[model samples]
Target chain A: MILDVDFHSGVPIYRQIVRQVQRLILSGILGEGHQMESVRDLSGRLKVNPMTISKAYSILESEGLLQRRRGIGLFVAPLAESRKASQSKALFDALLSDVAAAAVQMDVDLPQIISGLTEHYQKIHSQKEK
Target chain B: MILDVDFHSGVPIYRQIVRQVQRLILSGILGEGHQMESVRDLSGRLKVNPMTISKAYSILESEGLLQRRRGIGLFVAPLAESRKASQSKALFDALLSDVAAAAVQMDVDLPQIISGLTEHYQKIHSQKEK
Candidate 1:
């Protein structure tokens, strides 16, 4: 249930929350059926409005990433497990499209872009490991 | 001089214009000393407010990407050529950071991510050639 928000980022706070929560679910960091933090709790913790948190949660629910149970709370939807691979692929494809667009626009050839990605990947990977 | 804006996107239209124009300059599509279209003309062509285009151009001017030549018109800053490499590197680094963040969050392994990038790069490169 780890979440963070940057008020300064131009992106809306609710969208940021939705994206992070979606990523967490897709990554299996938040397993299927795992209960989500209450909206009040998450709002207080992130210092965001409760309505904002609720808006994010509702969006996730509409996307089938979260499920609301009677009186208990929201939990990661069971369907998330089966849809994980496809969802992850879609996410990666969108990311790669952005990278390719930027790389081509910058005149970065394939080899250079690949090498740079490798260097960055290793650096971030090592940092995460540590 | 080619730019497009998506009003439905959560990102501000002025920022979108700025980013596209920045990419055009950095990629050498808009060479140094190339005259920019008049704000009014560009606004009319893009069907956006003249002030929005002005805002974007002014931001670029402040960043030294565009320069105003007293009554002549705006032109690509001559400093752009020498700064291209460093600016391009900075842009790629930021882009790579985003990819790495998304990959790590989605539990995508380094090898898989590299392969995905390679496939995507080839696809985009070939499309550009066509």
Candidate 2:
């Protein structure tokens, strides 16, 4: 869809597309069994190459976000939410690894970052409910 | 440093390196003028390509998170906080655009996503303080 994508960010275009699809699914904008535009159709709409659109869809499909429906079209999959959980898990793993590396490079300890993370995470979690 | 790098992540190694350095500076562990190990040293330690380590530093330097000190070593730049701010802004922009696209595809209006974002954002913000 026309999200006015920024082609100049540090993030890759495919990733941008992936994130958009994820948000759509999570926000219930795109629900299970909902048909998505053909990659070519979306490419024409967004003015991006079919490869990029396919790349986005393919990555999401691998992650269980999109499902191939034999001959109809790309349908929003039922596992979208679970896929999101996995995606977030992947990100969290990256974040923690990065934090651990920082701990070592800065000659600090992991406990410090974990302590801060726990404290800040709690604060943020509590805030999310309000 | 020994952050136990994951080679299988969808995220590039350079970015993982950059994120670690960022966390270090933001947390005040690696203060201004803190000398980082030579790319070779880090590469040897991590068993990664030296080019990858340098690539990470180069990316961070361009973002103003690190400064190339002539003949000494890579020093943690004072602009780390500002750089962090910029990074977060970039991420926010991506998130917004993605959400917007989801709004369009689901045939939901942008206002719904914005309203939800605002509500959730405020709730999270308020909780963060506590």
Q: State which candidate has the highest DockQ.
A: 1
What would the per-residue lDDT of candidate 2 be over residues B6-120, giving only the tens digit for each residue? 7997778888888767666665667788888898899998899999999999998997778998787798887646665555444333333433333344434434333443444
Candidate 2 DockQ vs. native: 0.11
TM-score of each: 0.88, 0.55
Instruction: For residues A54-84, write the lDDT of model 1, one tens digit per residue.
Output: 9999999999899999899999988634579
TM-score of chain B of each: 0.87, 0.60
Reference-based lDDT, residue A24, model 1? 88
**Candidate 2 lDDT, A1-130, residue by residue in tens:** 4354667776787787887677667556677889988988888888889999899988889878789888888888886456655554444333333333333444344343334434444444455347
**lDDT leader:** 1
What candidate 1 gets wrong by more than 4 Å, as runs, is A80-82, B80-82
- In candidate 2, which residue pairs clash? A127-B123, A127-B124, A127-B127
Can you tell me which runs of candidate 2 are displaced by over 4 Å? A1-4, A59-71, A77-130, B1-4, B60-72, B77-130
Lowest lDDT 10-residue stretch of candidate 2 chain B: B92-101
